[model samples]
Target: MTSRPTPRRAVLTAALAVAAAASPFASATPAFAGASGSGPGPAEGAVDHRAWATFPQWSAGRGAGTRVIGGTRPGLVIGDPIGTHEYRDPHTGTTAAWEYATWLSPVRTLPAPATEVVVSFNARTPAGTWLQTELRGTYTDRTRTPWYVMGRWTSGDAAGDIRRTSVDGQGDGKSSVSTDTLAVDNPASGLRLASYELRLTLYRRPGTRLTPTVWRLGAMASDIPDRFTVPASRPGEGAGHRLRVPRYSQEIHKGQYPEYDNGGEAWCSPTSSQMVIEYWGHRPSREDLAWVDPAYADPQVCHAARHTYDNQYKGCGNWPFNAAYAATYPDLQAVVTRLRSLNDAERLVRAGIPLITSQSFLASELEGAGYGTAGHLMCVVGFTESGDVVANDPASPSNAAVERVYRRRQFENIWLRTKRHNAQGEVRNGSGGICYLYFPLRPTTRQARALASVGVR
Candidate 1:
């Protein structure tokens, strides 16, 4: 086994205390009450509408569909005619749009002593549009009056490729809006359940009607996780020496893979997953790599179509599809069934698992899609107490190694889209229908040996 540094004992001790305090109780009084869009003053406590809504699920390499991870809440529809057709791109005929708006009903109760409320969603804007997608939150108090305009996150401009905008005033050279996290907590309002709506709006020239291709919706809590500090290491210190992994191009060439000139193949999931293993000084047991290779070969295993009608592949390595696939497949029906049964966030926290992904941008996706650009991989490492997901995206030029926090709803919309589950209840490649290998966080010698017997090193 590799000798990785363990988290400080104090940090783990404090986290346990926080977890104990947040345990759910059957007798706990509901937080928010009344109906959605009631009045503006605080209602009862805070009922997270997102948790109760139904979300869509897209088959690996297929188009989008609706489903939720934990509950049976149905997903909302955006654009015209709900849940009928996906928003499509005008120039390329590809689909693009944020998922639908999912909010809690007014009659539902909120978590007890609700002090905060938040809503999040995953968005993928159309290419070449000035604006990618629009997300809005409407917080109503007991009176059904609009209490606050929470904030908005915008992607794109009048014309250009798609980009992600942060609501916290942090973005990658894209126009953005801001929201205050602390303002949502108001004891006096006596708010109960919070209702929210996320719309996938498109933008065109001043008088032109904008069109979008896809849209997704969901919600998460606004409470921040207790902060735990890691032992400080100087820049380029600790495991830095082992972090050097081959670039995507090099990996492809060295592995003797096909040249993706026709934009039909997807390397995003596999490439990114591989980077996480390599950078962390971990290698995929022979079994893990075996599952991954076949998964990448077959495009139909995922939500976004891997190949064009011309037989050219547009695999996960490149744009709109890269973003689209990440958004849709991660939360597919099969995978959600497994995730909903477990407390994922809590389990990861306990296991010290470092989550990661393939975060390709328009430029990278375009280049990779066009068979001209190399791919990039990223990691999602942290979350706030209230469940805001954070990523350690390596694609950003300035903060490549830094953490970027996103609302959990937004993060999950994308993350869930990429998750793959086979018939046997295991993670696999959606396109090729191959089972990917999984390694327990702490493997016993017998388990390791059993894995090796199946050709996993």
Candidate 2:
């Protein structure tokens, strides 16, 4: 789901109102300080910031007690995984600490002032065990803020599919499934050298013998330049500019499958995800999508919606959730990252991968598309000979009406401009220039080189 800023908020309100309202980050201030050696260099239109801390590189926590199981072993989780222990307090009859483990990442710096930062990884643990992923950053002043909880998820079938149930401190205890990863947003204004510490904590009941395991962890940050302008000349760019991508429309499925957020009308995210998933030649089996409407031709989209829905957020368009859901598929390397521009996106299209992009625009802001949306998700299938955007927009009335083109400049503004009104009516940038790339870990010969050139798996 592209982050349609306005209508989606309205959707959230309307849905919550019907249910009499469903339910729904960073610490402290440090003196500003400069980064060491200027940190990383930036790209022209956008900066791609990435820092990874796989288990092998992580050291057990100190000062506070830390726990580790088979450290960095294949098929083994190497983080804290202790069962709960209960004790009675003077005032309270009984008390318990479900949280029992902690793992920390080596401090690093974010290359840019990012609009979004997401931590992703794979893990396995028995049912009932809960895990919390949090991140804290050191400022230029050399002081660190307290940890910010990104998400809480329980372990699920590592090989079967990514089923992650995200829970809040106060949740219904319904487990969620993800594609082996979870993410949270850091809305800190202005970019700081935030590639600092990423903490992973594990929790479980006192009697539960099974412990949560974490196999891998990674963090990515994305930001775009204040403004981007297409170079005056590009000799061969946009020259064979059309990608062969299948189309799906969200409107067609509207109200069809109410179980998954009213089906199609609210399904642009999963519908768009399905198009890319199928483009990679992978589709869910009938049994996998059996929960969907039998009358629907593409039940896989419905399956995606069910899997990507965040119980706490109460929406299917959570950016990291969508990317994590795509990664659940076999042999796919997917991530919730941002692209610098159409130029960078075209690189993916040329590599045989289409991007699921988020944007918001007025109906009149973008031409060809019949309506405007506060936030929306669409596919960047290819470019026109003139360097325009050709998108597989699921917002259309039907699958046949899904494809459309827009001037490159106009589309860029809609896609790159991230400022929007919050629930309080103040404007702020949410996730900026966010896009997900779902591609095979290994590509065919024709696309192998292209994928390599763009740093895609």
Candidate 1 per-residue lDDT, tens place, 1-457, comes to 0111111101112222424223232133433222232211121112333322223331111122222232332333222322322444433455654333222223323344332333333343344332222233333444332333222223322233323321232221211122312123222233322333333333332222333323333233222221111121112111111123322321222222333322222333444444334433443345424423463432222112221011112223322222222333223210011111012332332233333332211222222122221223344444555555454443322223334555444334223221232224432211100112223423456543433322222
Summing lDDT over every window of 10 consecutive residues in candidate 1, give the lowest-scoring window: 1-10
TM-score of each: 0.32, 0.70
Q: What is the C-alpha RMSD of each candidate to the true structure, in Å?
A: 17.9, 9.3
Give the alpha carbon lDDT tens digit for every residue of 309-383 in model 2. Answer: 755555567665676566656666566665545666776677677889887666666888877666678898888
Q: Largest lDDT belongs to which candidate?
A: 2
User: What's the true lDDT of residue 135 in model 2?
Assistant: 65
Give me the overall lDDT of model 2: 0.55
